[model samples]
Target: MMSPGSRPLIPGSFLKIMFNQAFPGRPGVYWFLQGRKVIYVGKAKNLSRRLKSYPRQAGFDPKTKLLLAAADHLRWQGLDSEIEAILTEARLIKLYQPHFNLILKDDKTPVYLTITKAVYPRILITRQTGTFGPFSSTRTLRQILERLRHIFPYCDQPAGSRPCFYYHLGLCPGACIGVISRETYAKNITDIQLFFQNKKKRLVASLKKEMLNFAKAQKYEPAQAVQKQLEALSYFWQARVMSLELPRLSQDQIQLELNQLFGFRVNRIETYDISNLSGTNPTGAMVVATHGRPDKAQYRLFNIRSLATPNDPAMMAEMISRRLKHSEWAKPDLIIVDGGRTQIKAVKKLIPADIMVVGLAKKPDRLVGVNKPLDLNTAAARLLIQLRDEAHRFGRRQHLRLRSKTLFI
Candidate 1:
């Protein structure tokens, strides 16, 4: 029997009865039961440690408040290794559709730069998979395409074709007319791939030296052109470079950063903004940003549910209440209302005390909290502004688009 204050990992009076009757030692996976239904599933290396975690005061997160309220009883299955336990946890979560798990509904189709696997490899912008270059921006990729054409100098035409305009303009390596040997052409392709794979610094330096030599030898026009191409290549490289730091931060780091700056740790942040013309179609927008980046898919637009037309603060409060009722959406680390003190206070009335809330006033960009105006120069303040502004932009665009459509209809 569990001790006083040691509530079962899964909670409910009915589930508590069921859990007490069952054999508690065997552990492969655990399910959190609310009455007869399993709301969450987990695999435990040790059933005791995993089960104890749910009821422990220090182990709980503010976001897990709803889960704790709904929890009733804990059930488990015996498993071999930690790896198997992790795999089992994932499989069970997928099967159960737990409210706490982060669901990835959005497709992960990022754009890529493809070089066709051919003798005279032609470069093309495509979305097809199995390609090496997965560039984030099309504009950056276009710049890369230009630099590639200069460095590789492959033929735009078929093998037996006549020298094209590129060759006439001295851009091609004369591959179309077979002036560049097949061996050399193949070497160029290899070199191009190397550059794309971040092996370009040395090669670019060598190319620059060659261009300077050509300029000294009275080939002034070509040298200047090469110099220009080099500058473009340098910019292309800088834009696509990614940080080599740790991909995802730990929860401790997140909490520490938030606490030191904001006097509280931020688990999630929900920002609200109202968008409308003068007494026209007023709509409220709620954009959520977790940690730092905008989770656009989680963003929502509200077509003022209340009959109180043109009341922006009321519209904001309604949206907040409606969103708060949903079990899946976690309570925000901070609340950002996109208006002055009035809007901030309105939202505060709607939110529960477990969460932190603030507002960003547009003019001079100030943060309006419960008692005092937060200084905007701190790291947390900057992050709060970023989220608030993003919500404003998202809300404004949605409002404008809806208004435009209504006008058209």
Candidate 2:
């Protein structure tokens, strides 16, 4: 239970030990126990940080406060990624029916992703029973389906002669018009099944085998298409992790917090990160967030030209310099660099004094340039970190793409 004094129920040393044993920085689900009964269940993208932040969260909901008061002990199970964490959290909540998972337990509120039992299965978001999930976040589940549909197209429309809107966009396999056969459509459904089951490794292996067989048969076009799919899948998880934020933070709440933190209304935020492997194919990414959410249309990437070594600060400076030259681009209220004081120092001198700049340092994640005290537990900090991570993932993918191209050359 939460102590009457300042001490938390889970000791810092215990959390450290658990993390060390489970693998540090792993994402997973955690449960709160009141004696023998499980009272609450939650998922975290980073277990170590999430566990620590709970005690610092000033804006916790009423349910959270109630759970903390009753929870005598805590336990967790770490997983590979955020996707696994969400799925596992849902399964555990279903099994335990935890008292505090009130919104998740409601059949009408949370989304259920179903593959309708039909000749050509229609992927759907419904409140009824589902094959894949009773996913807690409706918006996230919708976005997941949209992303996956582009990779493995399937029909979501009613069976008819007319092709659906997605069919015209090449996001549906044309099940309505018989452009895809039952056997081939079944394969697509199988791939989706594997994906929802968190069997990405198996799905990838199968695709590889199929590609190999296609190459052996001299079906070069099909093999190349499969290769592209493989590359997309390679970067999919990293990109997905950036987009999926559990409980889905509000843009208004984040901006309000930032307004207080900076003493200025923050409407546009730009975050930068440099990615490289052994100083080869170094790339830099700039991601923007307007009104407290990522604006992907404004995202930009740079291939490091000025530096030939792993000088992140220099690369970051170069990226900023180029970005500043674009007068048409909307000016940012805040700029977040993914490093320490050196990174901030590198780019700060180049930018206008009117624009606020800060760095998000790791090991112990904290803001570098800001004079005000930072509370990592706040939604404002989380938004900044998310944008930084998005930039990192974007830059890394661009780096990998360059490296892969060089290999073929």
Clashes (N, CA, C under 3 Å) per candidate: 11, 1
Q: Let me know the TM-score candidate 2 reaches against the reference structure.
A: 0.53
Q: After superposition, how far is residue 204 of candidate 2 from its true place, in Å?
A: 1.6
Angstrom error of the Cα, residue 188, model 1: value is 57
In the range 46-111, model 1's lDDT, one tens digit per residue, is 565555555453245654555656666556766543333443554555456565443221243435
Please list the Cα RMSD from the true structure of every candidate, rounded to 1 decimal place: 21.5, 15.8
Per-candidate TM equals 0.37, 0.53
State residue 269's C-alpha deviation in candidate 1, in Å.
0.8
Off by over 4 Å in 1: 1-255, 371-377
